[model samples]
Target chain A: MRDELLELVMNKATGRASDEDLRRIDSILELEPHLWDDYNQWHQEIPALRGVICLAAATTEHQHQLPEQIRMKLRARMRTALSRSQPNYDRLMELVNTPPDPQLSWRWAVTPAVSLVAIVVISLVLFNNRPDAESAAQTEVANNQPSEATVSIAPVIQVALLDTVGVTRGADDSTRSQFQKAWPAVEVRQFNSSAEFRDWFIQWPAARGSVCKIFYNQGSGELKLIAKINGEEKAATFALKNDVSELSQIIQQAQARLVEWMQ
Target chain B: MNYPPIERLQSGDSEAWDIVFEWLWPKAIYISRQVLTPLAPSDAEDVVIEAFTSLFERIHKVYSTESLPSLLVAITRNHARSHLRKLSAIKRGYSKTIPMNIVLEEQLPSQEETPLESLATEELFDLLEQIRLELPERTARYIHEYYIEGLTRRDIAECYGVSVHTVSGNIRRGLRVLREKLKYKVICTDDLPFRMRNR
Candidate 1:
């Protein structure tokens, strides 16, 4: 929960944490049982987070278009697999030459329809359940759901403070009070040590399948909170001026959205 | 090109196969490139073909079209790992050996995958796309160019007509944003074994 300790952990992870820092971290680990959970969370998140950054970094490059030669090879391979004769090309030619459907053409047109059909057919083939596509659709539906429907998936508030904020009472006490004051009925747990934090997360109530994990990245001076709302992730970022009141306001807004969004 | 129903693939329909290839080839190649960067395009093609061949042979066993993408991805990953293992072996033969873990820095938690790990791969892929789309054009472009295109920090800075520090800062902020968004963990303390219990 200590920012200094976390800095040490990050350095240690990157092989830059000093022996002194490691000793301090070890001491923190012994005293603060719940710190492990936060550490573990950071551990799991960092690599994949960087991997994603690396992945997105790569996506900016050229699109991986299939080469003509490779396409030909794949086609030939397909033909061989299907035991089709060379003259079977007529099937493709005939299909192409066939008159376009007037209704289908007028309504959807060629490119959009083709792309749409390709997406559907490929999706049907590729995934057992198209969670990404379906979840996006569900989010759209969830976003526009009527007040009555919104009442069904009542949101629960669960918050994690990943780093210590130079506050008098520990970050946990302050964070809990902030939430308790806002929505007294919500279940709230404050994690100060690794074990407690990790345990709290591990024991997240089965009934409430979603949670909000909040942390302030001291290095970047940003306050970030992420919510898993019905399997879709929604996140908000605010520039931190090291003011708890400012963070509380941003968190309040996030809580309202979660109430509306959580299914 | 018009693609037939994927169901026909079960009966060895070449046309269906063609359509599936057309639709998934780019993705397969992209996945390969991501997993095995510095891979030549020809090698990427080979990896894709190898995976497709595996699918072709097991078409009958594929009970549903669902999971086909996951299946292809898994196969591609395995092939890429195999390539890495061989590369490691070759490098070992030549000089001081590097551990496979060092060689494959992004080693997955395969042996003891948590429930989160199992779902994280597919989910993260989508989350990354979402984050990219949500990011500013310049920041997103910087990320894509630096990570995807294998551009160095200096190159990206040069390309964007910005300082290297500026480019790095943008990327770092972007990564932090991504990290915050995707950090989903469930700590089931009660499930811990005796050794790890109450540690």
Candidate 2:
């Protein structure tokens, strides 16, 4: 509950936290795990919080208008979907278009039958006439899908961080917190020695499509990526001048490469 | 009593859709955007689009004229939920599951839906009115002015001889009270910036 912890948590949550910020957070949390519970509680509350805010809008009829481009985008997407000409949409719709006031009892009685027929009609459409229209629709969706990068859905990449042998091995992987801090959904494990790391690495089932990258710290700031993924061992190495200012830049480039490899 | 141009909407008239869009687009987007947090504004727009797409695909089935707005609201939220579910599933490597063909649960009959969800539009309005009555008069006034009357904080402040901050605080806190009373979660923590940015 410290202000610094809150700041760090928000920075990490909002994807603003640097690796150093993440490490500091890990170190802090390693010392005080209980603080995380309070933060996680608030974090878990967000979905429910979001649900209620929307529910408030629903009940109160909150007024809002999207920007023109967003409106246009949605409009295009809808037109494309309707253009597919989903079969029998008109038939079920005919049943549904009854006048609300006069048909209260009649509508209720028929709803079950209508839903049943609709389900059957939908099944037929999906199974019989669906593949081509759906594929075309999917192509349309992929083409029209928004490329705007948003961090709302956490990244799917699982990262493994390996450092030199001098770092002491502890009860938990120290690197775990660093990776967790770096990416919201990331799972991490660290081994202080090659013996310890290899023991775990040997157990990784290649059949499971597993992949691991070993970044070697060769002399003269040479960065090498040796990955054994799905039984394929591929190594890619590059050298950079190890000037202090450029060290950070080189490390960033190396990290970006590693990220792309993992993905 | 306000109805969309149903004939136009049914006939696939672009103008009908335009009319529907102008009428319900704001409310649909409002409901759609609220549930997507840490999500980009674009994702919320995508949810709105998905909801509209679903409605457009099934416009033939739109039975109740009055239920159209609420139905869109329901569909928008439903799509947002489906979107989040699909996202989590994809994270778990279930990318094979596609949501384009997902059925509209809110549109279909469901037995387990809460009474609140099943409430008619008039009933929901009446429920909100009752909840408003339970709120403190000042809180209710702030909410009414801010939402119903569409008054800006500065306008409300000037009218009530108070600072804009007070108006802002009251409106936000009043909304929280109303929201919590209705069993919803957080309001826009940042306030209605998209709407209130110019104001």
Candidate 3:
């Protein structure tokens, strides 16, 4: 069967047989079920050979280049071989044309590193300055109240949260009304204990930035105000703690302070 | 309106670059999607940007505008391969379990015909587009011509002024690289229809 197949293939190659003869050769190979595999394998080598010939032709001059007629003959022979051996030519071409994936680039690999570095640096700066922030809050609370004679109460006074909430005395109804109105906007509610504040902060991370403090003048009623903003230290005292009576007044004062800082 | 010349773009024309980016971005993104599967959709965009950046740096020598798609495809493939390599490294180090999204088959252009029984052709195309951006210029062009354009090696050789053998070799080498790079990411080609698999 191998000898017959070889003879048939050679005959077809040499043009001793017609196009019908080539078809007959294929049919014969198809009929010999066992030899079909070997025939197909042998046929597949044609493209590689054709590739080599094409390479040679590209390198050589006109005289050396295979004539068009001969090239045609060679191509026909190669095609016959390829039909049996080559995996689908169209499929191979498709695989070649398919584009590359874009997501795996070097820029992507380094972006996370850059982002991580930025985050770490920012965190370090914030973390290191926390102690100074606490001290500033304490000082602000101590200095918040000027002598009543020196500074008269303004209709809309801005209040900033400097520290933790504690009971304070001597806040009048007008001050309390101003404070209540301001308190909602600040988004912090006064809690009875430090544990309650901690629990609230745990439940709502947004509350961690809140300012809650109590101020008391001996014999005067205690004033407690809570205000929430971002990135401010917890348990910091405010200077306004002494004068602040209502949530509304505190918010108004805080907004004024924010505006002044911006200016 | 008149458009800026490619030579102006080669000379660092920001407007020309922007025009090039706008025109090619969607196609580049589409090619990336066809090649890369392991990467997220966002990563595909990153690959396109990277490819364009590299192209911009070497725009002076890139002879023809027709070559842009092929060049972009190459960059995408190389980038994606690198990404896959990194992902593999991370996987080995962390033993993390990555979830695979099962892409649904896309509807055909004609509403009258039901969608074919195959893997998501669009998704595969998208992955391919992603991978193309990461590949080198020669390899990506070969792949794009052979697979996306459905051109024969002889035809590609004629177009590029190269031998058919060289074209085939380029394609084969490109495919081999892709197969190695995308081995873990791609499902069995046999599972997909010939059209989708070829894509």
Candidate 4:
């Protein structure tokens, strides 16, 4: 429970806390605000948990296994290392892996080479038979394949954060909440890219709903803002010049368009 | 973990390698994070993974007294310095002088001892020994699985066929005992001196 409280506050300080954690913190605050006080006093120490004494704290010890995603990456790297370390063995196999009998070995080697020559000969025969084989093949493929719905990728502004640890205090969140207030009846969706939102919009069975997707990079201030309301697509790009008022204007413009679209 | 389960590792036993990896992973990552201070935390994981692979290749050469963390701390710091040097070189190539403070939060630490160094491999085992000796066997095991193995109290309870409360209580009791036993030198961070900050 001590570790739990420490982790909660640590997450909050690092700006990584979830909505659930915020609620939990609310309860903890009412019960023991002193805990936050203790956590805050450390200030710089919070990052390192420095000067703080601990015995079996899981996080402090790094006791947990590397998260599964990282472990899988490590496993892939190890597999590569295993393959790389045995290059000599691979070379040895290449030299002596076939039958020891000279005639049999010769046949074994010749069989694959012969088959490859036949394949090349056949390919050449097929290619020489057609004057416009490449274009004909492409047209054949186009005829056979179904037409895919085109998804135009709209470039939007995304705020690329300078410091992940500190995070963008409230620039992205406030902008999102502003639209939410304007579109009280509309469903707000967050997406990483305009293309993703478009793909989802096309697949929506109930495409009649007033659903919208806003994609903000939350760093670098580059955003790919696109909204699809009632199957009508609207997109606008606002370059973040490190100005909050510019971001506000983006919301205002988006809200203005949304109001017109809804009416 | 105090004394590494390295007999098998040194003898080229794969199972032994796993045990060693499991034991050293947390310790190695913890050290790397400390070494890579004022840098992105994500880089710490990569550094430790790299250190583990390096350590694996050179397992035979490792001395009994050598801790992987201590060995890799210098390497991680060196990596950070080299990375910073590259960043500076890039800035210079563009004929722009980015301030050192803007690029780096603090000057890369030198030979000063970090608190993580205090938790040496031997001391960790010695503490484990103390916990085992001081607490009941079941309580000690529960604490070990919960803390070191990263098991939840609920999971421990289900495994033991007891209520979650029982597991929590036992673990809490064990921690309280260790705190009482260690007294001054361990446990509480309450004594950590407060400092005034501009923020």
**Deviation in Å, model 2, residue A226 alpha carbon:** 43
**Stretches of candidate 2 above 4 Å error?**
A1-64, A74-263, B1-3, B39-41, B64-66, B95-199
Please give the CA lDDT of all the candidate structures: 0.51, 0.50, 0.41, 0.47
**Each model's interface RMSD (Å)?**
20.1, 16.8, 26.7, 13.3
Candidate topping DockQ: 2
Q: In order of the candidates, what TM-score does chain B achieve?
A: 0.48, 0.50, 0.45, 0.38
Per-residue lDDT value at A8 in model 3: 50
Looking at model 1 chain B, report the run of 10 residues with the lowest lDDT sum.
B97-106
Tens-place lDDT per residue, model 2, B1-199, is 3555565676666666665676777777776666566453446765676577667765777654444665677667666654555444434533232211122222222244333443433444444454544555465555455554466668888888989888766655655554444443122234231111110
lDDT of 4 by residue, A38-124 (tens): 555433344223211222332224455766676655554444434344453333233222223445434544555677699899978
Clashes of each: 25, 4, 103, 16
Query: For residues A1-263, what per-residue lDDT tens digits would candidate 3 score against the true structure?
Result: 56456435533443445678688777877788788754554343333222212211111111222234533432333233223322433332232233323443344435555776998999789767779878687558759866343453222212222111122212323433344455444433443222223233333232322333322111112222222323221121122333323334444555554333222
When superposed on Cα atoms, how far off is each prediction in RMSD? Answer: 29.0, 25.6, 25.3, 22.2
Model 1 misplaced stretches (Cα beyond 4 Å): A1-36, A49-62, A79-263, B1-3, B39-42, B63-66, B93-199
Q: Candidate 3: what is its chain A TM-score? A: 0.21
Single out the weakest 10-residue window by summed lDDT for candidate 2 chain A.
A91-100
- lDDT, candidate 1, B2-97, per-residue tens: 545557876666666666666667556776776667643335556566556545544555555534554555455555544444444333432332
Question: What tens-digit string does per-residue lDDT give for candidate 4 at B76-117?
Answer: 344444334433433343233222222222123323433322
Question: Compared with the true structure, what per-residue lDDT tens digits does model 2 show for residues A1-263?
Answer: 24455445544654556799788888887888887764564344333333333444453353565567866765665565555455434422332232224444344435555766998899678767667878787658768775333223322233444332223223454334433554445455543322233333334333444354433221123333445432444344444443223434544565675565444
